[model samples]
Target: MKDVPVYTKSQLALRNGQDKPQIWIAFKGVIYDVTDSRLWKNGKHYEHWAGQDLTLELKDAPHSSSVFERFKVIGILG
Candidate 1:
């Protein structure tokens, strides 16, 4: 398998739709590309925003973290 990329919080922030068209969210150190996800349009999902770690926030979400497994794994947060 290829090595997964690593990104810092500042680096991930640049991918936010407001700063850039790409949308990224991190959970448990894994970053997912949610740019194509209808739910993440404009980098906002309910109270969550792209380019930030959602590890702690998932507890408040209705769905489990498995929901993110379907999305593309872009990198890991370092």
Candidate 2:
């Protein structure tokens, strides 16, 4: 199996849609690119923002972790 890359929070911060156009979010130590997700346009989904870990915040969300099934796993958060 190919080893996935690990990124630091500082490096991840730059990927916010506004800062670098990547629009990424982290959950359970996994980073996902949400740039093409309509719900994540401008890096804001409801009250959630991109370029940060959403591990705890997602618990109150209307959906479950399954919502991440379709998004690609870009890396692991370090």
Candidate 3:
């Protein structure tokens, strides 16, 4: 089996949203759901992934290469 790659916060930011089912996002080796996470403003990260929103984010989190390898398109709220 191939090992999953990790990504940084800034790296994951590149693929905020796309038409894909899930986009992997790694923070400290732990992946998160960024699909429904708000990316419009700063300091609101916690609020977006506090409840059901996390489920969406987790579902969208990528499972392929790291952000450095390719761009994982995700959904961003306006």
Candidate 4:
């Protein structure tokens, strides 16, 4: 398998769509690109924002982590 790149929180912060036009969010140390997701348009999904870890926020979400499976894996948090 190909090695996934690792990205820092600050680096992830820049991909929030508003900052770099690539909306991304991290979960369980894995980053997924959500730029094309209508739910994530403008980097805001409900009250959650992109470019940050959402591990702790999932419990409040209506869906499971598998919801991220549709997006591309951008990197792993470091």
The candidate that achieves the highest lDDT relative to the unseen native structure: 4
Provide the global lDDT of candidate 3 against the true structure.
0.38
- For residues 1-78, could you state the per-residue lDDT of candidate 1 as single tens digits? 169988999999999999989999999998899999999999999999899999999999999988987999998999
Q: List runs of model 4 lying over 4 Å from the truth.
A: none
Q: Write the per-residue lDDT of candidate 2 for residues 10-34, one digit (tens) a residue.
A: 9889998988989999999999999
Quote the positional error of residue 68 for candidate 3 in Å. Answer: 23
Which wins on lDDT, candidate 2 or candidate 3? 2
**Model 4 over residues 16-70: C-alpha lDDT tens digits?**
8898999999999999999999999999999999989999999999899989889
RMSD (Cα, Å) for all candidates, in order, is: 1.2, 1.1, 11.7, 1.1
- What is each predicted model's overall lDDT from 0 to 1? 0.92, 0.92, 0.38, 0.93
Global Cα lDDT for candidate 1: 0.92
Superior candidate under lDDT, 3 versus 4 = 4
lDDT tens per residue, model 3, 5-77:
5454455544434423334344434444544434522213433321122333544545423532333333222
What TM-score would every model get versus the actual structure? 0.95, 0.95, 0.27, 0.95
